[model samples]
Target: MSYLKFDKTVMINLEESLTREVLRTNRKGAYHCTTVVDCNTRKYHGLLVMPVPAIDDDNHVLLSSMDETVIQHGAEFNLGLHKYQGNNFSPKGHKYIREYSSETVPRTVYRVGGVIFSKEKVFSLYENRIMIKYTLEDAHSATTLRFRPFLAFRSVKSLTQANGNVNQSFEEVTNGIKTCMYPGYPELYMQFNKKVKFVYEPNWYFGIEYPKEQERGYPYQEDLYVPGYFEVPIKKGESIIFSAGDSAVTTTRLKSLYEQEVDARTPRTSFFNCLKNSAQQFYFRPKEDDAYLLAGYPWFKVRARDLFVALPGCTLSIDDPVRFEKIMSTAVPALRAFMSQNSLDPVIRELEHPDVPLWAIWAIQQYAKAVGVEKARELYADFVHEILEYISGQKHPDMKLMDNGLLFANGRDKAITWMNSTINGKPVVSRSGYIVEFNSLWYNALCFYTELVGGAPVEKYDKIIKALDKSFPETFINGYNYLFDSVSGSTVDWSVRPNMIFAVALTYSPLTRMQKRSVLDIVTKELLTPKGLRSLSPKSGGYKPYYVGPQYERDLAYHQGTAWPWLLGAYLEAYLRVFGKGGVPFAERMLISMEEEMSLHCIGTIPELFDGNPPFTGRGAISFAMNVAAILRVVDLLKMYNAE
Candidate 1:
């Protein structure tokens, strides 16, 4: 049985069903998301969401949802649910849901009286389109299905209002109708494979509330426009395909187009198979022939730091070196100009993060391990050299080469590092100094570059390594035995954080065997949870056990003490490195919850984080790509250890 399949019990419970969401994505950047019961509780939930490059860079919710109704024997059953102002849910469509499964593409089975029908959603692998195929499983009598399409032509971050700006007009195509709500948006096509009657009654749907947005203290109420309904008859043992796309389709070939998409998908039989499939959803090939991994669903776009951090597991776990090369090339255009710009921030955001270059080098090293050093050099040597030279110069204050041969990143006013949560225009956790992970990654990058190509003066590189080896451990180690999180001008932020794991886990470390062991022991004792390591140990005064409430509270607790599942990969690496083969069973035990997680929350994918407290509840972004990659890495590491 598929673990993601929800039975009648889960489907009937409104509270439970609302909490569990399903996601489907096309490799070209379009996606479909909604609650298990087909009710949208969050502002991000939509039937079709995709980016419109001509209008704006961000994603827009062109088609919010399609409410379906079944009619038989002059009786009507509404199979759609909607939440309005004052916490009222209309129609209660989930009552008719027999089962909902995301095992393949999102499939929902509904039984309305003697008539049984199933709805399966599939996204085109190469285009911004979604097709929902409805099949009548059993019918005692003739039936009709009415589909009302709700349109929200606005950015995903904002809500829509019933304004005069909306163009309430539509044009008829072959077997579809094309409509554009306003200017600066793509024309949306709602089509079907067979003949269907379209009733043109356009009106605004007002007072719709999104609970998740209300909880986040944002404007939660919005109005969506409905472009009438389509009346399509249902025949026993027959299926009809409903297509929605940015551009008009060849309506006659709709079934063939959907069939091709379904046939192209890889079979997902096991939990790991589902995870591997979900991991593939993150990889999108944009116009430049460059493949980029989205950080997470709904909100996050591709970031320079997140791309590298997620690359190793995404590519190496699947043994796709060509994909690794494709993703790596996406960073080249900006990185090649880093030296001239005197800054390494490749993303459009104004913030400067020093960890981007560090993670990039680490990803390169991982690529080398996967496809050998020779192939890796042929692919990444020039890019790596350019990045190294850029970092080798005097740049931002938080990320600079110090006289003591250590890389110092002291982002005083700006939280430039990964602990980049700011509240009230100030950092929540101010970790600005010669951080442990920064130096370790810097050292690793330098060593990898030197090994790859030795054009740099050997004496200068050697001198820096010798000085770092002499000073890193001596200055950072506190009495409790782990390295300080950061140190700036005699002031040491001595909190135990997961960042120190990189000090031992990286290809080149600045720690001895004994020190590595000490660091691992401290981390395991205070920070290691079943899911991952906490951002801060409980011993620290700044620890926040729960990640809850609005934006400010969540941001303050984001890195304060929240347990990040992605950090588990690094901790497992350091644990295995220090303990060798003996750590395999324990590492395996730590990952057993992942199998359980496959059935919960966002089915078949790991959450971005969990609460710091016991019974660490999954929080933050659901279906996070980095978290999935981290788990894949640990699985690979354990397999290697067992082989040895």
Candidate 2:
């Protein structure tokens, strides 16, 4: 049995197919993401979601979906499925699906009456284009396929309305038609490989609700414009290619273009390969030689902290040193851009997270190990010293250096850390002052700076290090052996959160051997799960078991108890550090448990987060770049320990 192929039993069931999603992305910030049955369940779901440089930097949903219908003789069978406003389904094409396989590219085989055909989808490697090949396997008579293009032409975060302002005209190109709905937006081209008839009928489909958006408490319903439909004749053993992109393609060269796209992708046959491929999808190179990683798919932008935390695993683990340097180069300019705005923050104020600059130092240290210290320092030393100086000089209300010589972030802005979910202006999971991970990252950053660049900075780092060594162990550790999550004025949050793992996992840990072992033991007993480590221990109060229901409810559980797969990287690193080579088996087993996930949701990619409870159902963003990087990092750790 193929790991990624769903049989008729699962495909025929609309509920089962709708819950699962498939995501195909080009490394250059473009994607085709939707449900397995071609029914969109989220506002972000689209056939051509790409960045329009002329309009804005954010991605937009141009073509929402393309519905295909098979016409034979005088009868027509709709092969496109859609979920309407009142839990009603139209066309219901999933019933005709015999099998859905993502073993290679996303391939679906459909059987209607006496006609048997298959559809394969492939996105372009570096462009905003998607090609769908429809092959008629065995048809009794002439079959004509009709393709209807649904247009959204709006930002992924917003809903589109059928307004009178939209242009309802098309410009004819070679075997294709190009049209633009709004000003400043890129023109969309719908091209066909064979001679086809374009029916110029425009109408509005109203009250299309996205259940995922509704759950997130956002406006989920919108009106989509159907520009027209393309009618193409087909016979048995013949295949036709349909292209949707901003630029028109040469119809005669469609086969070569499809072959090139398929050949460009790295085959995903195993867990490691699947993760490697997933890592590649996150690398977005907008300009020549400048690369940055988007944090997650279907809705996340390029976050500073996420870029540094996920860089080593996404690039280095796969042995792509060139990309590592490319990413580093881009970060320098990003920091420079922030500095230009006269802000001490690592990134812009809106995009700033206090811990991001600290994470950059940790990323530099990891990059140093891959490419020698001399080379790494030669490239990143200035960037590192500048960030450290900026962070040290600033004394913000939210993030400040206290008399205790440890960094403190006032839990006032809980969004400053990774547990950033908020409800009604209040943080769901508050970790305010003297955060564990922030301190650990700060300590490591200082140590790394002292080791790399010795000057006035070294003396300052030495004094802070001495003070942290005394204050950290004295104030944080409880009688239970594990450290407290955070310490405010008089209140000690003794929550068994997974943030403590970083203390032992970083390059320069302030925790001693005994302290590291205790932290690992407690984390293993409480937070560790098959999918990843839970944000909060189930034994703790206000532990959310499920990540469902409405927006506020989901936010309450997002960080309160959601299991984040990205934390597995830190857990695996700490396990190796504490137990040396002996911990290799445990790390291997942990990574192996997620192998079947390759065939599950977001096929071939790791998810953003999972539910805290048993059977840890993958939830949150479908395709997360950091989660894939975390898995790759764990694989690297295991290889190092097992080799010894």
Candidate 3:
């Protein structure tokens, strides 16, 4: 049996199948995302969702979905699912599903009467294309397959109505038809490996609902246009390949292209392998020379903080240091550009976030740990000095190095940290003033850079380092043996947040051994969950444990008490730091429970956050790069400890 196989019982149940989603990306900014039953619960779900740089930065759903029909003896059984108005599902093709597995490519097997059929899907690794291969495994007699294409041709964030503006005209290509819904959008080319019949009957399917959007209090209904259907004959043991892409391809090469893509996939045979495969999916290279790591699936773009935080674990933890260097080569220049000119790259955003440069240094620290300090210094020495000088010389707009040797930023008007959930243009949790993690990362970066350069650089920052050692504990560590979340002049926020975990987690932490133990104990007691650490402690006032309701309510709970899996990377690192080899068993148990997450929510990948309460349901973005990278880092840490 496949590691990620679901039987007929699970496949037929909408509750079990619809909540579990599968995602396939083409390394470029295109993807195919849908529920396990092939139903699109969200507007972002589509068969071919790709970025149109000319239209907008957002991904557009060119080919919304395709319905397949099995025709035998003049009777047709449509093997496709779509949710319409009034909580109804049309076609109801999920009932015919016998098994669904994704060990390599996503394959769905169906048994309609005496005929057995299967469909396998794979996204092209280097191009904006999605390929589906259909196999008629067994048939009592001859069978005919019919495919009807539904085109949305709208941005993922907006819904489209049945309008008079649609082009509605299509041109015939080799065994296919190419159509463009609107101007400034690339034409969609849908082709087959062999000859087929095309029927151009254009119509609009109205009131197609996306329940996920409805739940989130957004516009949930749209109209999809279907231009035509294709029909082809099939024998008992014959297979055909279908390709949908932005550009036209040679019809004869479709079969070979699909096979080559499938053959190159990494099998998700184990928990570690599953994470490794998911980590590689975040690689987004718009141009040949520029590469970036996307924050998460469905909606997230390439943000500066997420790229640096997720870089080491996503690449180095997967034992691919070459990728680590490759991504950094492009990213470091962007970082420099942002620092010097206050300019942001069009693709890589959020470079102005106060802690991004600090996170970049921390990422380089991870590289130094993996492949000696000498190599890291050889590559990142100038960049490291530039960042340090930028902050210390007061070149940053928001971040300021204080006389106390801690970095301070004002978040009263806007958010500067990663807990950047806001409502009505103001920060929800404005953790301003001297934040714990920022200082922790600052101290760590200073020490690492000083050591990387040795003698002179050590003396250069010695006074500031000494001041931080005394002032860090004096400002943050309270009488309760736990660090304060944030400290201002008159008021101090003592919320038990996961931010304090960085005080004990970083390589060159300023916290003493006893202080590290105390902080870890408080974190494990107050914020730690099976999924990860809660953003805020429940014991504090205004603690919202569950992340639900509409946009406003969800944003209120986004950082109040919602659990984030990315925090686990720091928690485990602190645990091992405080307990050494004796902590291995407990750390391993935490990781083992995380393995059960592979089969939950988004199969073989981790979500962005979860409910802080019991039965912690996964929420937010389906496949988060930071969550996957953090888990992979835990796996790497465990392997090193076990081998030692």
Per-model TM-score on C-alpha atoms: 0.96, 0.93, 0.99
Clashing pairs in 1: 398-409, 398-410
Which segments of model 2 are wrong by more than 4 Å? 1-3, 53-57, 161-165, 336-351, 394-398, 402-404, 450-460
lDDT of 1 at 567: 86
What are the runs in model 1 whose C-alpha is more than 4 Å off?
Answer: 343-351, 395-397, 453-457
lDDT of 3 at 591: 88
- Off-target runs (Cα >4 Å) in candidate 3 are 454-457
Residue 116's lDDT in candidate 1: 90
Give the higher-TM-score candidate: 1 or 3: 3
Task: Summing lDDT over every window of 10 consecutive residues in candidate 1, give the lowest-scoring window.
Answer: 343-352
Give candidate 3's error at residue 297 in angstroms. 0.8
Report the CA-based lDDT of candidate 2 relative to the real structure.
0.85
Candidate that beats the other on TM-score, 1 or 2, i.e. the better one = 1
lDDT of 2 at 493: 90
Higher-scoring candidate on lDDT, 1 or 2: 2
Please estimate how well model 1 matches the true structure, expressed as its whole-model Cα lDDT: 0.83
Clashes of 3: 0
What range of 10 consecutive residues in model 3 has the weakest lDDT sum? Answer: 454-463
Best-performing candidate as measured by lDDT = 3
Please give, for residues 1-644, the per-residue lDDT of candidate 3 as tens digits.
Answer: 78999999999999899999999987787999999999999999999999999978999999989999999999999999999988999999999999999999999999999999999999999998999999999999879999999999999999999999999999999989999999999989999999999998999999999999998899999899999899999999899999999999999999889989988988998999899989999999998888889999989999999999999989999888889999999899998998899888888888999899999999998998899889999999899999999999998898889988999988779988999999999999988889999999999988988878853557657778898999999999999999988988978997889999999989888889999999999999999999999999999999998988899999999999999999988899899988988999999989876899888888999999999999999999999999999989988998989899
